[model samples]
Target: MTARRPTAIDIVEVGPRDGLQNDSRHLSTEAKVEMIAKLAGAGLRRIEAASFVNPKRVPQMADAEAVLARVVDLPGVSVSGLVLNGRGFERALAAGLREISFVAVATDTMAARNQGTTARGLVETWAGIAKRAEAEGLFRSVTIAVAFGCPFEGEVPLARVIEIARALAESGADEISLADTIGVATPLAVEERFAALSEAVPGLPMRAHFHNTRNTGYANADAALRSGVTVLDASLGGLGGCPFAPGATGNIATEDLVSMLERDRVATGVSLELLRDATLWLEGEMGRRLPAHGAHVSPWPRVLAA
Candidate 1:
C-alpha cells in the first residue's frame, strides 16, 4: 500500500447508458428507466443514464428524451447523459439533463469512426458547447476516448493526451475523464497517464473510464486510486463496448469496483449488497449470465459492511 491515498472516491454508474448501448437485445425506455431507478436505490448518486444521439446511428439509445424524463427526478441522484456533437448537446439540454458528458477521441481514425470528426474538430465543438452549457448552468464534462491506445492508430502518445487535457481545461470543462476505450491500459500506464493529466490540468477534477477488454480494469482502477484520482466510471454487470470500436467489451463492474474500493477502506458511499442485487437484476434483464465477478459469487464480509 502507498504511504497515502484518498480516503474516499466517487464512482459514476455508467450501466444504463454505456452498458446497454452495444447490447444485442435492446431494452425498452421503460426498462431503461427501471434499471436507473434500481441503481439509484443502490446508492449511486451520479448515474450516466442516457445518450443523446441519432437513432439511426445508435438504435439502442433511441428514446433518450423519454428515458431522461422519467429518471431525472431520482431523489438525491444527479442523472447525466452522453452527447457527441452540437445537436446532441442541444438535445441533452432540451431533454433536461443537468450534466452533459462529451467524448473526444485521441486518434484521427477513431475520431472519424466514433464521432465523424477529427480530434481537433471535436475540440472546436467542445469550445462552443462549453460556452452555451455553462450559460445554461449545466455541469460540463468531457471524456478523452482511446486515451491509452487506439484500435486503428495503435499507440496514442502521452504528449498528445496531455495536450488534449490542457485544451479541455482551458475551454471551461468542469471535469475531464481519460477513457481506456479499448481496455489496453495496464496498472503502470494507468498511474502514468493520470499523473500526467493531473500535472497538465492541475485542479480540474479528473475521472477514469476503463474497460476489461484485457482483464486489467480492476488493476487500473487500483492504480488510479493510488495516483490520487477521486472519480472512476464503471457499468453494472460489466456490460459495455464501443459499437464502432471492434472487439472492445466489458466495463469494470459497479459491484466489483465498489467491493474492491470499500475493501481498501476507501469510502465510495455505495452499498455493495445493494449493488450486487442490482447486478443480478441486470443479468436477468440482459437474459444471460454477465461477466461481472462480484455479483456471481458470495458477498464478502467487508462488502456487506459497505
Candidate 2:
C-alpha cells in the first residue's frame, strides 16, 4: 500500500470567542486584545476574535466590537466573528468586519436550546442572513453547528447535516463548517460522516470544529484532514465549552493541534513558542489554568538533556 501524503492544515483559532464565552471569569478588553496580539505574533493567520451576541447570555463577549476594532488592523491576521442572528450579523458588518460565521444546529431540540428556534427556522434565518451578507459584501462564511452529533438529541443523522450543508451552500455561503458541538464523535464516525459530506458537497470549503471532551478530538481532527478538510477550529489552551451542553469540555487545544500538525510535517503556519506564550498569558489573565497539553507538558528539558 502507498503512504498517504500529509496535507496543509489551516488552524483557525477560536479561543477569543468560543473559549472565553464559556468562561466564568469576565476578561477586560485590554486582556482580550493582548491575547489576540500574542496569537498573531505567534504566526496564527486566522483567528475568530469575538462573537456579536446578547450580552445577557454571554457577558464575556460584551466587548466584542471593541476587541475586533483593536485586532483587525494587525498585519497578516484575518479576524472573524460569530453571529447568531440578523442583528448580530449587522453588528459585525457595522464594525467593519469582513469575515463572519453564523451557525444553526441539526436537530430541533438542540437548535431550540442553542438558538431559541427550530432547526428549520434557524436554517431559513441563516439563509436570509447569508443573502443579506452577500449583498452587503461583508459576510465571509457560515457554519452549521452540531452537524456531526447533537447533545439534546443524540446521534444526528448524516442526512440532516448534508441537507443543511447543501442549503447553506445554495444560500450563497462561501464556506460551510461541521461542529462536534457535544464531542460525541469517534474516529470512525468522523471519517464516515466527513466522507459523506465530501461526496455530497464537492469542492465546497469546509471546516471541522471538534471538542476534546471524549479525548477523540485529535484523532477526529486527523480523520478530518485525511478526509480532505483543510480548516480546523481550535482554541488556545483549550478554552471553550458549549454553554448549552453541560459537561462539554474545551475545544481542541490550539497548542496541541499545532504540535500534532507540525510533528506530522503538516503546514499550519503557526509557531509553537508563540502559541505557548499566548496560552500562558491567557491563563494569567483568566486567573486560572486552561487545558493545553503542550503548555501543561513541556518538552524543553527533554530536548535539552538529549
Decoy 1 TM-score against native = 0.96
Worst 10 residues of 2 by lDDT: 1-10
Instruction: Tell me how far the alpha carbon of residue 199 in candidate 2 is from the true structure, in angstroms, after superposition.
Output: 1.3
Off by over 4 Å in 2: 1-6, 300-302
Give the alpha carbon lDDT tens digit for every residue of 195-215 in model 2: 888787898877889998888
- Candidate 1 deviant stretches above 4 angstroms: 1-3, 244-248, 302-306
Kindly list the per-residue Cα lDDT of model 1 for residues 120-173, writing each as its tens digit. 899888999999999999999899999999889999999999888888778899
- Cα shift from native, residue 74, model 2 (Å): 1.6
Candidate with the greatest lDDT versus the true structure = 1
Write down the TM-score for model 2: 0.94
Q: Could you tell me the lDDT of residue 241 within candidate 1?
A: 76
